[model samples]
Target: MERQADWRQEKAQALARARVVVIKVGSAVLTDAQGLSTPVLESLARQMAALRTAPDGHERRLVLVSSGAVAAGRAVLRAHGHSGETSGLSARQAAAAVGQGQLMRAWDEVFRAYDFPTSQVLLTRDDLRARQRFLNARNTFAELMDWGVLPIVNENDTVSVSELKFGDNDCLASLLVNLIGADLYINLTSAPGVYAANPQEVPDAGILECVEDVAGLDLGRMCGGKTSVGTGGMYSKLQAARRAAQLGVPTLILPGREADVLARAFGGEAVGTWVRPEEHAIPRRKFWLAYQSDPAGTVLVD
Candidate 1:
């Protein structure tokens, strides 16, 4: 009971102190069987607009990492002979190219209703792998926040090859948290939160309210396969949360399908799983060296 109380207090404090937040909405939450879900976009936009103003009336900055361009593009191309499923990398990239514009337009229109301007920021893994490029991207994000324009970020799937692809927005969002120095990381998904076991396989599985040791969790048994509409699954979210924890940023995995979910979660309602961060943040340089940089060459010491 005392541990629960302590975590609840910490959760409230984290939410209250979060001035810059990175929210990553998975494709399952953003898309439907047809394509991009305009209704979901509108609902999320409304909630996000409300969340922009803190309880004390201070302006909060939000950076959205959205995934759905490929799904949207595939939906559109289905009429033009693109069929049941696409497996090739080129096919997926083609779909992203087609749907990128549509995705942006939908977001622009939805957010515009709230009188909020937005900027589309597409990135590739390679873009952030280099030191100068990483700094440049950070500066761009800073300027976007300064101008009060919400930066709608996505992977540059159209040009990204297998070697440089982010795989999913989950990975991208985790990286962005470190790059932007975001106070909080919110991952809105189809599920309510992380479960003790794969909920599909075990109907009795319960949600984990707070995870104090993300690294100690057995993700293999707890996660399942990717969603039909998205590249990531619970495993990816867990990995993302783990990264955020290492960076000393608290992560919330909430149900994106619930209307006003963001508002509810931010309003101190226990709506999802909260992963606590480390007591001391790992140094940025050390983190970058371990996670961001690629090995230049392989050495055969043996």
Candidate 2:
């Protein structure tokens, strides 16, 4: 029990000391059959507001990576006499175009109510692939943080094609961790944490609280696939955690719908799975180049 206590304390300290945090909210947590959950957004905004006023007198910088454009678009489409179950890339793109604005509007209203300013930042994989563009994006984020403006980042789904897409917000969140050198990466999902098996299929499945090495685990089989409304599942979250760990950024995956989830998480409560960073940390510039930068060409040398 002493060892466990030490582990818990260590995680609490890591969370408490995190000056810069990147939070990614999945579509499953943000949306339902009807539409976006105002209650959830309200709670999240409150927590974010609280985070801005740290006890240590140091201002915390936060960046939110939100996914729900497609789901939100579907609701808009349904209201316009279009089927919510619209298929095909073009149809989904159209939905994203309509929903993106609505999604931001909802976020803006919620944050504005709390007296917080938020800026929308839409990005594609291609945007971060080029060296000059990557640096430019990094500078933009720095400026936003310096100005005390919270950036709400999302994939440019409306304009991005299959080849240029980041695939899911999970990957994008991990890249953001490196992009801004965030101290912590929080992945708020529908489920509590990583499970031993599918809880739906196995009634007695257990949650793993601490994952020291995500690469050692068979996450694909353990966590399974994507959600109905979102492209990423538990497996993608684990992948994101591993990527963040590579750069010495710890990641926490927790249930977003829980009452004061963000507050409880930073308050030293062991609420979800914590992926610890590796002992040897990679240089920020090197990590960005290796992971974020797209390779021009591969030359096989003997």
lDDT of 1 by residue, 1-302 (tens): 13344888999988888899999998999998889999999999999888888888889999999999998998899867868656578888888999999999999999999988999999999988998899999999999999999999999998999889888999999999988989899999999899989987999999999888999989888898999889999999999999989888999999999979988887889889999987778987677777787889787996
Predictions in order: lDDT? 0.91, 0.88
Candidate 1, residue 42: lDDT: 98
Model 2, residue pairs in steric clash: none
**Best-fitting candidate, measured by lDDT?**
1
Query: Lowest-lDDT window of 10 residues in candidate 1?
Result: 1-10
Tens digits of lDDT, candidate 2, 1-302: 13344557768878778899999999999998877889989999999989986668788999999999888999877887886455688888888888899889999999998888999999999888887898899999999999989999999998999878988999999999988889999999999888878776777988888987877877756877689999999989999998898898889999999999989888877788888887677898888788767668889999
State TM-scores per candidate.
Answer: 0.95, 0.94
**Alpha-carbon shift of residue 227 in model 1 (angstroms):** 0.7
Q: Clash number for every model?
A: 0, 0
